[model samples]
Target chain A: MAIVSGHPTEKYVRIDRLPHIWCPGCGMGIIFNAFARAIDELGIDPKKIVVVSGIGCSGRASGYWAYDGFHTTHGRPIPFAMGLKLARPDLHVVVISGDGDLLAIGGNHFIHAARRNVDILVILVNNFNYGMTGGQVGPTTPEGTRTTTTPYGNYLESPFNVVWLAAASGAVYVARWTVYHVRNLTESIKTAMQMRGFRVIEVVSTCPTDFGRRNRLPDPLDNLRYLKEHAVYKKNPDPREADIIWGKKFVIGEFVKIEGKETFGDRIRRIIQIAQSRLRKSGSH
Target chain B: MTGEIKPGIYFWSGNDAIAEGAIFAGCRFFAGYPITPSNEVSERLSWRLPQVGGIFVQMEDEIASIAAIIGASWGGLKAMTATSGPGFSLMQENIGLAVMMEVPIVVANIQRGGPSTGLPTMIGMGDVQQARWGTHGPHEIIALSPSTIQEAFDLTIRAFNLAEKFRTPVILLADEGLSHLYERVVVPDPRDVIIVNRKMAKDPRNYLPYKADDDLVPPMAPVGEGFRIQTTGLTHDERGYPAINAEAQNRLIKRLIDKIRKRKHEIIDYEMYKCEDAEIVVVSYGSVARSAKSAVDMAREEKIKVGLLKLKTIWPFPDEVIFEMAKKVKKFIVAEVNEGQITREVERASRGQADVFWVGNYGGRWIYPEEILDKILEVR
Candidate 1:
């Protein structure tokens, strides 16, 4: 999350730890590139934004961040961000993680934080499988897909429609975009960062080293070409129709933008007022 | 972070006292889940925390609860959580996170019998060893157990102090009996209570978040303070970047262990009754210490030279005191709600010079002083 505005992007990169773990042709660089462009566009003080990441291929992104960042356990960055945001209302908190870490092992936290309308931005990178773990079957592993865990076609379960889930769980802003749509994804990130309450942007990315090789698309270019060919921008889209069925059309756009709703922080402020008033009446202070 | 606690004497339950103690210790954030014997802690704080302008959140589960407190602590506030065996088990992973990140937070584990949810409403001392070794890694925890209601209050404030002073996750190890027991507690005036705060990192230009000074603890750069807070579960270097190597691991892990070990003198504490001249030391902690203390008194009346060592801090194991006491004692009658958790520690500390005997059960029933007295007399 190199979101340093008014400065060189290298300011945010941990150059000494260079030659990062991400493989060649992985879409993480693109998503990270878009993420940086977004933070750059916002012009917010780089130090003001804290990025939290769950364990995954994308989770490694936090270690590479120039800003204050926490590379947390698998599927735990959301709650960690919630705690941080609640404690320091002045600082902006963001969760940059992956689908397996966010939806599979960490599925409960994702929905709960969204439901509580916690003030944090979640940039969930979807690599279609557990990329860090070598393309294992995961929560977002499409049905009838091959994975390390599922040698045969994965037919035991269906994938989660991340946008729909976020919308259903009461996210104030929800959107999805393939890494190929860098400009649109960057714009979405800019828009979400400017707003309040729980916001989510699911960036559909490629896992060329693992998921891509397991499938027929071994080359990173093939994966990117597939994403570009399948991507379609939907106007006034319903999140339910936002699923990415393999080798088929998939919708990408801002699905929800119902702003001005109360957030977890707002409710706490109100609760503090009511509670302090009662405390004064009780004279217990 | 200054929350007022009027200096006065009042009857309070262990659960209620911990909630107040946390606020007294300047804890401004609490995230907890509802589990038997520990729900009162979260329930009381639902109103209490907000009253002091502190934040309270009943998180999705035990994992989230611990995670939230860790996050809040890094956000530059004293934070805590309360749970039981089942919840504590769920929190073990993130508890490692707190240890690895060296974040200061408190977790109150009101013990209940368990292998896997064995008894939700009953007592067990099973978590003593678990609190120290539950997380996967080289982890050292500061666990304080309270014997009475007053101790429950005082020890909790001590727990927070230890957490802040060391930048470590401190465990307040109480049990179902202590949690439910009600007794008078003297709340000291806020002006008189000792408070330890984070040694904040200044001069963002030269700040190294994970680089320790002679103290073995690095000064923290809290959120919104200009300096970056970069950390990970992986073995890290002084810059707080991931450095997964033998060299980094050797340095980082040694510091993590030594930070508490070298300073164990400041952290280790226990109470002794009639121990100066006694041959048999009945060792116990938490509510079990109550029965053991009574047994010591009863044994002394019968002319048996016995004493009680009620441990307040259980993690560094306080082996220095045990080692010194072992030279003079005939044996140690270790009592616990669990079968033999702390008994092994006693045996190890004594190194076979003194026989170590255990008198306890994991039946979810409270042990009586007579049981411990029997063991003391048997050892005598």
Candidate 2:
């Protein structure tokens, strides 16, 4: 078996199915590699890993992984993963999805999961467009950007800043990185895996097949360079200021690192303990 | 040994009995929101579940409540949620998913008046059809109705049992009247009770999550068990991949329906009251059956040959029992909180052998014994 270096094992990967579904030079490949490296470096048992994905190209990552996988409906990965984690706390639950899947249809579950402080990792690949369905405008699609859906000079609409939203919604750990920073992306995933509560890492990747073609960068490599030039590290003093016609300025880094409130599991355990004690006392009375 | 049996027992609602039963059944996780008549189930469970090392959460909404319970169930804990008509409607999509994914869950719907927010606290059996066909597509459902507090406890236990055995969602259908009516319930000890756990796949390797054995029910493994299993709502092959072929679809659908349908003999449950030598039989369930039984007694005082068939298991309707009774009885009077709900099932089961009279009340009121007796007298 031809194994990708730093991948845990063949058992966790579908080796024969490689030459992945993503087009050549797509940034999702970079994100996928970083995720594998993070899992390998963490050294957690492959048997204990679960990757949940929603309906999108990013959702296909679950099928490619060797661990327990779930490819659920659009915008439903959070609740589904919540079930998996709650049922088996020992398992490492990670969710992979696109910007639209997490922010649009599944926005409710995402906020609530973070608010409840469930222990799970969410890796959101923000490629700025709905790539799998032929380059439709998404929640994160820059306003006024030309796409199949928004063909005419786009009407202005601000995109959701997912990292800030998650931070505000009580996520214990929140970070944002682009595909150009592969090492940083891997490190963020590792940190998220170690976090005790809801951790979300938003990866701004290039969708050359859809978003790139719409934006006049038909060549996939040119899209990669665009991300590299415009994306800035949290520590960078002065980064290139490339503005999307209708979206917020692209800034990336680990923006939030707050400690989690009591998790749902912990609360449940406490409730059970209290109930047991009360029952004992009531019996005596 | 000759101590007087408690006739007018302690004042406790049907919801109280269900809560107590769930606790007795070793349910440790309860997630629910407060909705009128069904709210008491949550209230009672919130207090009682904790008393036995169980957790109780009052979720923000019914959707999250069901989701949380599913989470708890997968965590290897017996879990449940309670709601009325509107809340139950909200849970339909997830309920369907649970069925397709073969996740064992128990949902208690205390029926209320509604197409939407019809009666918040009024009694109605409008959800009878919803319980059977609310979520889209073809699948077998196990639903139970209770007439008294004792039956409530008993049927709740059965609901959990059927859910675990079939790896499907089980509905405990109690109307608003029964939910709020107080009666005495005797809970059996856990050791004396038979609890069904999900069949765990012994071998992790080559484990197909959706592959059914001879019983047409697949073994379930927890998420952490090193098993690579996929779950979806789409029609799937044995390996859990979405399959489009007609044969694969037929096999999957048949197994889903047959698992519960074929076990009708084991699942069929009812209480027959003076059904023998009766010219008229009153068919009822939940709280309406209580009135039906009284109506039967009153009819007997007048020397009318009236009988009662109280349905405890409502879905996968007791067709054989009904058919047999139809041959013997002159007429079957279907009494329920809603208009013409269970009456249709009675008519179908009767197959035109006997006249089916529906004595239904839709104004958020329980059917009175006199009203049902009068209807029986008219039919007779």
Best by DockQ: 1
- Return the TM-scores of chain A for each candidate in numbered order: 0.96, 0.90
Q: How much is the lDDT of residue A22 in candidate 2?
A: 82
Q: What's the C-alpha lDDT at position A208 in model 1?
A: 80
Candidate 2 lDDT for residue A126: 89
Interface RMSD of 1: 2.2
TM-score of chain A of 1: 0.96
Model 2: residues with Cα > 4 Å off, grouped in runs: A1-9, A15-28, A129-137, A146-157, A208-219, A236-249, A259-261, A278-285, B1-11
| Local distance difference test, candidate 1 | 0.89
lDDT of 2: 0.80
Task: Assess each model's interface with DockQ, reporting 2 decimals per model.
Answer: 0.66, 0.44
RMSD of 1: 2.1
Scored by TM-score, the top model is: 1
Q: List ranges where model 1 is wrong by over 4 Å.
A: A1-8, B1-3
lDDT of each: 0.89, 0.80
Give residue A56's lDDT in candidate 2 (0 to 100): 87
Interface RMSD, prediction 2: 6.3
TM-scores of all candidate predictions against the true structure: 0.98, 0.91
